[model samples]
Target: MKKAYKKVDFPTEKIRKFLEPGPIVLVSSRWEGKENIMTMGWHTVLEFSPSLVGCMITAENHSFDMIEKSGECVINIPTVDLIDEIIGIGNSSGADTDKFNKFGLTAEKASIIKAPLIKECFANYECKLVDKQLLSKYNFFIFEVVKAHVATSSKYPKTVHYLGEGIFMVSGRHIAFPEKFKPENL
Candidate 1:
């Protein structure tokens, strides 16, 4: 019952359509009393022990300067229900818009970082900038998660993944095979 695979030439720029990693996250930053939020999908977990995460925020984005200068930000994971807010935040700039007020999202004070957390998000990760060697060349930032807050009501979140060009796929289903893995691996 498996469909046959076919090979065809594809555009290199459009490879993200097939290799989009993880879920979309709302990155909130604060600097000099100014706060902003930007929807990001280019982040990845680089390590576990140090709780390292890497993301690329374009210099043109209003949040880029804030996060870079403040050296801290909160990465909030929103569920499928906030799809509209996610799209709105990504489409609009924080330059002249108060994203929290414009999108009707509540900003809660973070414990360690000045950046506020989006209360409606499923999880919030308080991060501090740890490395920026790649920022100048690739606009990439490396952050260390200093604190984390996650909801316990749901075992897993129904997150959304962007497939480029305004297309999104909601997270679906869960499968576990603990027995198939070694004890140490598990």
Candidate 2:
């Protein structure tokens, strides 16, 4: 049975707080000899076949220009254990701070991209900028995941999700219903 709920008028601007509570990732990028890390939650998986991912990085971010010019970046998934580092990285500036050194995060060389992967993260997706059509208008970037690295020890890692303001929610228990889906869909 479904539970009853109260519907209240919500702020239009804060609607994302309820709709887009996806996993927060640390995007690492490099240009020339400089490397930086930025915390991002405004991202989504657009396709499976070619593994396409789209994200929004405001032009004001320090890593924005670096990624735009480098045409590559590594999206690292940090677990709930690294919540402090994640929040700190998001609040700090890469232009003035050496995020890797400041946050005490390890930067491992990526397989196909110059951007280093965050060693502490559970998974890392090395991506190449494939489309820029919506970039100028929305600060959105379309990337193709060229390579992926994941930890095998744990099948599921607890990740954090932003809920606007200073609050965050950590991923909870897992639920599976693969049996109910079609074989091909699995």
Candidate 3:
């Protein structure tokens, strides 16, 4: 059964929620011995084979300078279990707080980048900036994954997604189907 509903114009300023289920990412960057981590939700996968990623790191973020200068960062995927820590990290700035110590997060060095990876995360991707064309104009940076790591125990980790207004949606149970839809190289 279907029911008719009234439609109205939406506000452009509050349209972030319209793009629901945007994955929340913890970006870790280091420059000149100063390491910082920032919570990011404005990122997306641009390519598959080379694992290209695009992220918007505004000038207001402290890690923005570290990432821009070092050209490297680790995209850490945290699970729903760390929701409180996630919120804490996002709300607090790394400029004045030692987020790693304050949040009790362990850091492990990456294979290809100088930035440390958050050991508590389920997955970590060491990335290097490959494009800078949109940096000045859109505060955007394109990166290529150089190395990747996933926790064996948390293979089926439940990730978190931002829904705006300080709310989040946790990833649900896995759904699998016949293999015909999947590509051979995937």
Candidate 3 wrong stretches, greater than 4 Å: 1-22, 179-186
- Per lDDT, the best of the predicted structures is 1
In the range 1-186, model 3's lDDT, one tens digit per residue, is 111112222232222221223668899988888778899999877766566788998889999888999999998878777888889999999899888888888777788789998888776778899999999999999998777776556335577898889989887876666575668532
Ranking by TM-score: 1, 2, 3
Q: Name the candidate, 1 or 3, with the larger lDDT value.
A: 1
How well is each residue in 45-135 modelled by candidate 1, as lDDT tens digits? 7766577788999999999999999999998878888999999999999999999999988888887889998888877788899999999
How much lDDT does candidate 3 score?
A: 0.77
> How high is the lDDT of residue 166 in model 3?
92
List residue ranges in candidate 1 displaced over 4 A: 1-21
Indicate the TM-score of model 3: 0.84
Whole-model Cα lDDT of every candidate shown, in order: 0.82, 0.81, 0.77
TM-score of 2: 0.87
lDDT of 2: 0.81
For every candidate, C-alpha RMSD to the true structure in Å = 11.1, 11.2, 12.2
Better of 2 and 3 by lDDT: 2
